[model samples]
Target: MVAYRSKVVERIELPARERRERALEEAGYNVFELPSEDVYIDLLTDSGTGAMSDAQWAALMRGDESYAGSRSFDELESAVAEVMGFSRVVPTHQGRGAENVLYGALLSDGDVVPNNTHFDTTRAHVANQGADPVDCPVAGARDPTADGEFKGNFSLERAREVVDDVGAERVPLVIQTITNNSAAGQPVSVENTRQVREFADRIDATFVIDACRFAENAAFVRRREDEFADYAIDEIAREQLRHADAVVMSGKKDGLANAGGFVATDDADLFERCKQRAILYEGFPTYGGMSGRDVAAMAVGLREAVEEGYVTDRLEEIQAFADLLEDAGVPVYTPPGGHAVYLDAGAALPHLDAADFPGQALVCELYREGGVRGVELGSFAFPDTDRPELVRLAVPRRTYHGEHFEHVADTAAAVLEKRESVSGLEVVSEPANPELRHFTAALAPLSD
Candidate 1:
């Protein structure tokens, strides 16, 4: 395939290490609190940070700004229908909005929701509703270095056990996140989804999908699943969604849009309920929480994201970065997932124990050493859980080129060279609200 060429039109100057360290200290050692100008390569997340294509920008100008039933909504609805095989599309400002409305409508006190692995926000939303969120990832998923092809697969046996233990009545729904973000962005097999759907049906529970990276997941399915090798990406995506009762999507990731999300379903009753909640919390059913321009960009991005050439190119870019890190002897999660490369902070900084938050430590060191910002996906992000300490470098869609990744790889290598000197961190101040504490938690380097 021929490569598509694009030119850069904007540039920003980054601050020096001393300036960045002062900013980091003022921000209380939270990478999230640092200003963009202070950082060099920002990889905090792929969410809402991708660069829009020329066509997407053009579509934004053609946005139809109507209070209800806007033309842009029509296009978005049509795109969602065609790409996801869903009949309804209730737009939102971002993925969590979709989750908020969907879970709010379905969950009640004592309800239990199971997933392969719940991303931080998803887990928080479920917990907020007085519902228990359980993770039933496949056994291989726990091992970061495992070469399992479908590490994101849900454990069917565990799912059945949960359903039996909690009783079907107490179980509101079973969610499966495509390209499981919390589990190193691993892809779930098409066969796995079918099996989970059957299990959900047997237990009389709803099976919804957290399809933030559906396109990228589809690309993996086409390459990894023998039966799907002959199928187009859109067809593979539709087949995957066919097993789900509904889909909650963050258009920010796969939709290639800067900001937009939606809850899609073919079930008329669920659609109606979600639509009502969307209106109450988000906006009118058509526009939800997004503007007309965002909707238009998302509609175009939804289509562009699933193209065979584009998916291949994007995956290659991500893998190249991961390969670079691995070559430098960094302990990276292998069989690289669709979106991000996860560095094993525990192994990278063996001197720091889990209690010291090695992941958070690595995140700080990367910024202090190279002005590169990344998010910690380990204990700092989930204090109650025993999840491994990891620093995630999520690649934004079409945002950076090969040169940028090379720079990141070099920065990471530089940090590793002085890994022994990198100290651990302890909480200086934590939010009163325990939920999602990593976003606002303050920390300080431990004394030698």
Candidate 2:
């Protein structure tokens, strides 16, 4: 079928190449690309739940009584203990920092770190360390339900298969978490988490919780299962801790605090081993590289994040965004789970295939028409270089007001209208094994 551009266009040739990109920008149009915008409506990820109160921020800035051997460490430790109910906790700069220590210390070059799907950074750390980061394709990994709700649920059988395929001695940690980021915020139910617990016990594999999206998981628990629905946030958090040896938190998202994270566990021996990593990457074990105030803030933030209204508010906004797109006839990730919406760019623009940079093209178009930004997921976030990419839009916790929904909806619909005429994408070569792969956005030029 012949493609067509939006009817509301007036094309003008520009002498300078920069002018061409500038023209799109000057129009105040955009779909936020990663690393570019503050108000990016992102569903692509989350630490867990994010953005602590100003009080928490102030506390973090106050600096705990301990810098290295400070009381801050004790305060922070106590806070970590309160959340996970584990006395043994080590602080890291952030989530990946925690991963570095975990993999650097525990995993040898030949070891395997298995999970449902490791985040981009986690995968990089494992691969860079010369260990195979195995994402045991959950049973339903290949075929996700339309809504993508079940994507986070890993098959115990798949875990078994991977373990059997690669002996347990070679597998260091079985770690994965809530709102499996790569899977459209699909949640792994408590039952599945428990199953993992039993499996870990059977295999003697160390189970690590990437509680990055723990709050969302908790929300799901309350929504999906009745028994959990009534449980208080802190109570539910404590119970979830039963299944894992330790947790790596990204305070940015989960703790609701600013820059700090923790590697925590109740296992005394493993806890001591984890401390060494602190000395190397983080500061002294006492402070674990974070100020006591951050500890205090996170401690307080963690509790506040669990407030019923807060989680509910975030969920409502996400649904509202989803509703906006759905009403516009957009092919959104059905049954949108958490913050942000996944517009099936391939389906939305059948004229442009996902293989030809559908996500990147769509994102560029949105930016050219509306000043909203989002990331690519199926088209970019997904694994398998030769697979569909996702243009992931991550909506931060409480990032938008009601008016913003209209901006997102109208902008998306306008782009979808020009779907047929939008240019397809081609990878102009990316660096091999680079940490951040850069892609230049281009539309197949209007040819003769």
Candidate 3:
């Protein structure tokens, strides 16, 4: 095992209880709306929240800035081709930008897209294009206590039903989100990916991998899938991508970068259409929506993200964090997941119903109790849907340490102790766009 240390540190002081209370009230009870200064530990997301490595920083310094054909773009393209095994690459500002560009090119009104489970933004982007996003995660995913190694696997049966209902023509894209975020960040198995690929081919739909956390997913495959037990993480990752016709990735997550994303594909027709969409929605095909330096840093981060030692350590750390929560009597998703430890908010606060926003209530309590901010992935995020009430503590890559998670565990335990006291929230104000309302929605305590 390789030892790692923080060569740099930034001091952060926990906000006072009263200040947190005021901040929460001022932000209308939305954790995402709170200022960073009030948050001691921010687990709102892992996207663009990681610390850059020395190599990434060096790459940034040497980045070439040009309007049309920058060397930085070439480097990023080469890295994506090598790591993801795609012949073409298109950079974007972030994961959602990649989603927007790709979906814009493929989706049509009344079309259907299926995945293991679509994350918040993915679902929103699909809806924005007047397309429906269907989730087909295995049944085990809904049961937080189910100790399955690959709960993230897409259900081929469920997908078949969708295809039959919509007709294969209306189903344009079939995606698998590796390390499925919406399903407690669980990892997809290689067998499942191959089967999904076959299913897609049968339906004449394109197979796409929502590969934001592909490296972490590959690590899980190496451990759980018997066939790939001896495979290195990168080798397993390549195999996973090999099953896909195209890939959309958030370089921020597994790439270990602050910001950047890409769409890669072997299909020339789809690649050309995606590039045109990128030119309109993002930027020129070369730079897309990223700065030259960000593109360069992403190139280095992508390679670093798959190093055997680094990927293994990342999984071990997340598992250790989950162990801490379980030891504290906190209800967490079993077997842990690649990036986050999801709290079963419904189990913790059984008194609160789905309409009461149990997950958001838990998020509020955590921030007020310990200045720790976590995001809700339940009714609040997917309103009117039968999703699990989960509060996700997404640890940023190479950011917080064990002490931080220890504090989170203790805080969560405290919240569970006073679970009955926690009140559900009613939306006071929200954006007109219901798909992305959770980000800016205002809420007040539910009336007794």
Candidate 4:
């Protein structure tokens, strides 16, 4: 396959084996704390890690640095409206900032927000608002072995169960995360989105979309859903988002920018409330928590993210990464996903239990073996939540090539060969907020 875009000016050199070991020890076995200089392949996250396109870089110069009524804000608002079908836009620093700003306006104490699967930050933001975040991903998502195409789909039955238990009046929001990050970056179907929309309407709750990877999810919908087989990627994206009343998006993901996010809605009342919150927590509504240049770049990225060529290349790259891992006898979550390849840490390290943190152990082993940094999506991330133990190798858009992923596969295979020798991790120190502990938790080998 030909390169869609190519320019590699910066170069990186991996730290020595001893340096990598020392770095791991210094970080207390937490990959998140490891300095980038010591890591070879940094898969810690896709957020703010993607390479910006030339067009986006050029858009930076068009930024209006005004404190209010900036031209850059107009560009972003227009992009959000044209691509996501939202009428109002509230800028934020990042995705969690958007979640915080929007949820503060929408959720009250004891309110329930049902989602396909809430990622770490989303869950934390909801909890911080004194509301409950209930995950209702399809059954297929729970089983790492399942090969379903739309495993990220919100389970209407499960969500209904939550509503039935909590009463519809207590359910204020129904959020659907595109390419559900917590569920192995699986894609949610348009049919599922429609079903969720109907459910939200029946319950008189606002339907929201956590649209970090909206374009990726739409690409999957176009490939898997018969009804959308003929639709363009952008059309599919708009169709999926159309079912939602509002959206909280992290521009870092699908937007292909390093920073920036937005909360968009069609409801005037809700939009006004979110804007108020943004003004209080973030900066002025025009710039929010970002600079004008960042907003402008994000505007360009939002449009580029929906292009069919870019979406196809990204999906293919992730698929190839998953394939490479599987061929190397690494246990992986099936059907692949949009942004990352999830390793079934429990399956790979069957000797360890959930309490032992197999996912964290796999993360540590991968880094120690090859200076590769990935994150645990299991007990460490969710803490007491009964979910699959998986390690996520999130690929940054336009950052790496086939060779990098090939090296990752080889590293994972090496870890698997020594799987039994890999000791489980025990948390030595964690944050007060259990939901956000994974971000800064310190761990140690169980054997120690």
Worst 10 residues of 4 by lDDT: 1-10
Clashes of 1: 0
Instruction: Looking at model 3, report the run of 10 residues with the lowest lDDT sum.
Output: 1-10
Q: In every candidate, how many clashes are there?
A: 0, 39, 0, 0
lDDT by residue (1-448, candidate 2, tens digit) is: 1111223322322123344357544422222233333323433344443445666666667756556666656666777677667787788777778878776766778878777766677777888888887665454443323534456776677677778888988876787766677666667777777888888778877888888767767777777767787887666777876688888788767576666778888778887888887788887876666667766677666666666766677677778878888898777765666655666777766776555667767766665556555666554444364333555566766444566677778878988887777876655445466433433232342232
lDDT score, candidate 1: 0.90
| Candidate 4 lDDT by residue in tens digits, 324-368 | 999999999998899999999999999999999999999998999
Q: How many Å off is the CA of 302 in candidate 3? A: 0.6
Q: TM-score each candidate.
A: 0.98, 0.84, 0.98, 0.98
After superposition on all CA atoms, how large is the RMSD of candidate 3?
1.0
Instruction: Identify the runs in model 1 with alpha carbons over 4 angstroms from their true place.
Output: none
State the RMSD for candidate 2.
7.5
lDDT of 3 by residue, 1-448 (tens): 4347778899998999999999999999999899898999999999999889989999999988797999999998888888878889988999999999898888989999999999888999999999999999998899998878899999999999998898999998999999899999999999999999999999999899999999999999998999998988788999999999889999999888898899999889999999998999899988888889999999999998889888888889889999999999999988799899999999999999998999999999999999999999999988877889999999999888878989999999998888889999989899987878999999998989
- Tell me how candidate 4 scores on lDDT: 0.91
Cα misplacement distance, residue 56 of candidate 2 (Å): 1.6
**Cα lDDT listed for each candidate:** 0.90, 0.66, 0.92, 0.91
Query: Cα deviation in Å at residue 391, candidate 4?
Result: 0.4
